[model samples]
Target: MPLMNWDSSLDVGVDKMNDEHQQILSLMNHIYDAREAGRSGPDVIALVDRLGQVTIDHFRDEEAYMEQIGYAGIASHKLIHKDLLDKFTGYASDIKGSGGQVPEKFLTFLKLWLTAHIRGIDMKYSPKADLLKAG
Candidate 1:
């Protein structure tokens, strides 16, 4: 089974962002697959690192989109992004130092955070906020 699943509730009413979210979900699964396949510790760590980088890039893109659309909640949203990144980095660091399978708590964190962030937070900037919603 995949480590992450993207559902309709996570749709933020923007094509680009939704695509990025799907990509992130795929990367999460790749990390799980690597570990399950008994890939080297470094290999798994690298996947984790790649996930982090991809998430950072996605957040930057999302923020830029919000700015282009004049999202009123950009400042607070950016702060939330920062907090999420900090927590993600902490989990990545822990996983790297431990040198084993991804922790269950980490997986839980990813699932919960992505679900809520997209469905709850991201959706706030959707609809009237996102010009592409009408598309």
Candidate 2:
């Protein structure tokens, strides 16, 4: 089973952003699977790097979309993204430095971050986008 499953409940009502979010969830699952399969070291490191890149790309796209739509909370939203990115980067670096044994703490952190961010932050934008789409 995948670590993180994407569903409509996670959608923000923006097609592009929703797609990016799904991709991120898929990447998270991949990482979890790798860990569970006892595949660490360079393989895990590579997966972490890919996750980092995808995260950065998704955040940039989301921020750009917010800007285009003149979302009032864009600044705060970007800051949240930055904080999350920093956390993820730290995790990746720590794993790489440790020769690829990802700490249990890091896995827990990922799960918590994904759950909170998706349910709280991401969902907050959904209503507005849905209204726009309906119009």
Candidate No. with top TM-score: 2
Please state the error at residue 54 of candidate 2 in Å: 0.4
Candidate 1 lDDT, 1-135, residue by residue in tens? 887778877787789999999988988888777766766477788888999999999999999999998989999999999999999999999988988458778877888888889877898788634555565
Question: Tens digit of lDDT per residue, candidate 2, span 31-68?
Answer: 88888888888988888899889989988888888788
Clashes of 2: 0
The lDDT leader among the candidates is: 1
Q: Candidate 1 overall Cα lDDT vs. reference?
A: 0.85
Clashes of each: 0, 0
